[model samples]
Target chain A: MRIGELARRSGVSVRALRYYEEQSLLDADRTPGGQRDYPDGAVDRVQLIQQLYAAGLSSRTIVELLPCVSTGTATQSMFDRLLTERDRIGVRMDELAQAKAKLDRVIEQVLAAGLTRDGATGSAPVGS
Target chain B: MRIGELARRSGVSVRALRYYEEQSLLDADRTPGGQRDYPDGAVDRVQLIQQLYAAGLSSRTIVELLPCVSTGTATQSMFDRLLTERDRIGVRMDELAQAKAKLDRVIEQVLAAGLTRDGATGSAPVGS
Candidate 1:
């Protein structure tokens, strides 16, 4: 497999793939003629990297955790770190939920007002 | 209130407040020496802007929607847009949940494996 195919299959940009390689979170072999040759595993590897990144793991942390995660093994330190990361994700999820609820209230209020686009305000309920 | 005061109250950077001003998501009056003077309401306005931004609104969309949201009025278009934004946030939350679950599985696996830090693997149940 080549880098472009890996990027396409993983749904990540080639630039990001390169950065992953630089971070040691991903690896590819050099071909005899100086091109990058990725094994089939690279696709899954890139996707995993994305998942960890989305889970709020920094690149350095991902580098540290990848081997243990891939092998289904973890040191006590890694376990502790994973718990902390999980709590952080929970905090972020709560923030997003709060934002969503605020938007929902605004949306509901506007709907009750019965307004219209195109420079027109619909007749809202009259003194109800 | 001055710009710095607004930033302190809103918990956003002075630079971000300026950018919000540039995007018209925020406004302030000019003082005699050209310092920006924000009304007391500006604190709440900036916090609202932060919430909308967290809800994944572009600055332009925030600019368009702020008046209706603040006034508790909404055009039909804005209502539809808000629904879409809410849906997008839902999808993002689902993705975050999935990532957390994946990490949970990994953590559980490692715990069951009973690994330890300091280059030691803890003892696991023998043939259980």
Candidate 2:
């Protein structure tokens, strides 16, 4: 399929597809006229790449792991690396949760403080 | 306080504090020799700004919200805006968690498929 078709099917832009190719995250064979042509599995591969990106994996890491996913044969060290990546994602998730909880607490405090001030000070001075 | 003292107390850099002032996220009154001097609550305010940043809010958003936080009195619309921001953070956290789960599933699939391949194919070829 042409680049446009592949991009449309994958829900990625033509420019992004080209960038992906440049990044070696996606590849397509050149046609006789020099246009790029993709095989049947190209769309799925792009989807997998997008999934990896959303999963907090860098393009560098995804490139290294792509072979394992495709070949279905990874070494013991590869498994160790995957486990390490999983743990790193967990750590980031925890940080994000902590940040969220901090914000929640701040909002709650603001609400309670505003209520008490309104009761004591008889309506806070409003600004535009 | 001097910039260094505030930096040490707030756990932000002198360069970053200057940058924050430039970005209008922070301000310090000029001293006799034109050096910056911060009031007592400046450290707490800087910590609050850092927390806001970690909550995924931009400097611009924090700038707009700072008055509300400092004045200790926000209008009803300001409260609405705060709630909206909180909801947005919640959505992003959900997306991050979903992405982590997708990665977890991919890792699991890779492990299971690798085990099956090793059992049936009898020692898969390892790549460097």
Candidate 3:
């Protein structure tokens, strides 16, 4: 398939697809006529890239992970390494959860203060 | 405290502190000598900004949330709005968790495939 098809199916923009190729996150073969040719698995690959991008992974990180995902291999040491990587992800998940909690707290604090301000002032300002 | 002190205490760089101020995420008063003077809670605010940045929130988002957080007010409707904001944070947390899970799966797949390759080939290549 062409780039357009991959982008459309993956819900990623054409510009992002081109950027991913430039960043080495995606690869496409060149035909004799100079058109890009992609295999059937390209759609899934693009989808995966989109997911990684949305997850806030850098393009470099995605490029490093793509091969391991595509091949699916694990020696003894590799299995241990994968476990470590999984643990790192767990840490990041915790960090994100913490941030979310902080945000919630901040919002609650603000709402409470806003109410107090209005009650004491007897009228809320336009901006408030 | 000085920028260096703020940076050390907050675990954010002096450059980042300047950047944050330029981005309006942090505000500082000036002394008669024209140096920046931070209030007592500046460190906490800076830490909050760093947390938000690490959680993948943009500077713009942090700026928008700052006023509400600093004031700490809530009317009756404000509490409901705060709840909604918390829900949005919850959604973002879920998305980040999902991304981390996907990364773990990809890593696991890669490690398994690598082991299979080594087993079948009797020896793994340099790149593998």
Model 2: residues with Cα > 4 Å off, grouped in runs: A71-73, A76-81, A106-128, B70-72, B109-128
Which stretch of 10 consecutive residues in model 2 chain A shows the poorest summed lDDT?
A115-124
Poorly placed runs, candidate 1 (over 4 Å): A120-128, B119-128
Chain B TM-score, candidate 1? 0.83
- Best candidate according to TM-score: 1
lDDT values, one for every candidate: 0.80, 0.75, 0.70
lDDT of 2 by residue, A1-128 (tens): 99999999999999988988888888899999999999979999998888677667888888867766776556665666677777876776676677667656657766766632223434544323
B1-128, model 2: which lDDT tens digit per residue?
Answer: 99999999999999989988988988889988999999989998898888778767888888867765665556666666677877877776676677667657667776665543333444454333
lDDT of 1 by residue, B68-126 (tens): 77877766677777778788888777877887887788888876776655475544422
Tens-place lDDT per residue, model 3, B9-50, is 888888999999999998898889988888878999998777
Q: If the candidates were sorted by their DockQ against the true structure, best first, what order would they fall in?
A: 1, 3, 2
Each model's interface RMSD (Å)?
2.5, 4.7, 4.6
Q: Is candidate 1 or candidate 3 better by DockQ?
A: 1
DockQ of each: 0.58, 0.34, 0.48
Given candidate 2, what's the lDDT at residue B59? 85
Docking class of 2: acceptable
Model no. 1, DockQ: 0.58
Q: For candidate 3, lDDT tens digit of each residue in A19-112?
A: 9889998889998998788899888888887766666667776675565556665555555644665566576667778877876776655644
